[model samples]
Target: MAPKQDKKVEEEEDAIYEVEEIVDHRRSKTKHNMVEYLIKWKDYAPEFNTWEKEHNVYSKGLINIYWAKQPYTLTQFKKKTHEGESSIPKKRPASSQATKIDRKQLAQEIKSSQISTSPPTGLVWTDIDAIVNVFHSEPNTYFAEVKWPGGKRNTYIPTRIIKKYNPLKLIYYYESQLEFYLPP
Candidate 1:
């Protein structure tokens, strides 16, 4: 009888009982229920553009979130105090921009980053524009610089070498070994 009651409560709660496997964009130690996080953004963040926390988060934050390509557990994530955050500049990625940046010798650097980072994920893929940007951009660039797309350039990167972050490649996150798929 007690078990039956627990089930009812769980169902009524609309419990998000699963999580998807995804990579941590920040390289930080947080990869719990990435699925729920993205899903929430897709469902409620914005109709077409980025999704920012209307009250807790700021603008351009949503752009950064999508670029991460990670997942989080809805139930577990919501339980937290929800105060952690980072700065959100007033900009979007190169994809959302009109101006284009082209650098020389970017292919080699991206090839290196890919060669070094690829095997772990099994594969990686990217569009021609990103491929061009990676080749044109400098090497070992961080997500923040790239997240803004055309807003802020990664000048720290050597123009002599460039690399791209191909989304097609299958990156293997340590969390992927687990079995959890968020609601469609």
Candidate 2:
């Protein structure tokens, strides 16, 4: 019985030591905080790593030792701190920064402008009348808001199938729409 009790004590000590050495330190970004460190268990894969508060890990003295041993530069630290987000400052929506009257005035200006009715040379108007607005574009695709002669509006038309049409104007128009409508 005495021998068994001694062996059990030894096993508990070994378990404590295992926990001490198993901490693998890494950093991450959280919504509330700009920077955080993820504590990964030595024997576990990266997917199982958990985000731990700096205060909690610092109290244990594990992170201090880890940071001292790692030879990372300032740029690397910034990169780690801002992981999962763009480095560039996001632009706010134009409407949020402008007055309601200004927005109404701008809308009126856009509505009053006369876009050319005739299709560019070699392009046929076909079933549509004129391009009134544009919504989005990608590498090989473009979406436009078109108007018909009867004052009907088609909000989404793919520009790729339109023959002899250059999509630059539509792409520029879409970007402008994003500037006005999208919240950063």
Candidate 3:
């Protein structure tokens, strides 16, 4: 009974905003085949437009209409591959590999020392104070400069490593970059 009442309250609190239009669409970088729609709300200004996950926007009619007007199909969008040089400068492979091996060794040492850094079944516990920047080294490979808590100099860590740990930070950085580059 309490659960039902709680659900009802939750439904009541949820605001249903009318989607004015699907302004744009982009395939998600992290999730294959997943697309995000830029939603413009009826009563909101352009600044309020947001990129919503495929499942988050519920209006089937709007989604279908948006796709219908698109010149390319989702399949075509998925296959539009670009092999141009990365905007971000590349790092030396030798240095990058050395840094990665050191981190792995440190994690192993921590585990052997019984420092309770992480549970036995999980990945090693890494403390990332912040992600300073992201760089693309090659096609489908990115690196992030991460700051540590102990005042150590920032280290270049592969984005794949960071993605498994803190995906939101990467998302935020990319989103911010889009805002600057996207045409008004």
Give the number of the best model, judged by TM-score.
3
How do the residues 1-184 of candidate 3 rate in per-residue lDDT, one tens digit apiece? 9999999899757645677899999888789678899999887999999999988875544665565455445565667642243546243343556556544564444334432222123223255666655655456866665666657555666677667777776776666444122232
Candidate 1 C-alpha lDDT tens digits along 11-103: 768743222212122211354333222223323323333322323222223433343222332232354422243334333333522222212
Off by over 4 Å in 2: 1-28, 31-34, 42-47, 58-60, 73-184
> Measured by C-alpha RMSD in angstroms, how accurate is candidate 3?
18.6
Q: What overall lDDT goes with each candidate model?
A: 0.31, 0.46, 0.62
For candidate 1, report its TM-score. Answer: 0.19
Candidate 1 error regions (>4 Å): 1-38, 41-65, 68-88, 93-110, 114-184
What are the per-model C-alpha RMSD values against the true structure? 14.8, 21.9, 18.6
TM-score for every candidate vs. truth?
0.19, 0.23, 0.36
| RMSD versus native structure for model 1 | 14.8
Worst 10 residues of 2 by lDDT: 16-25
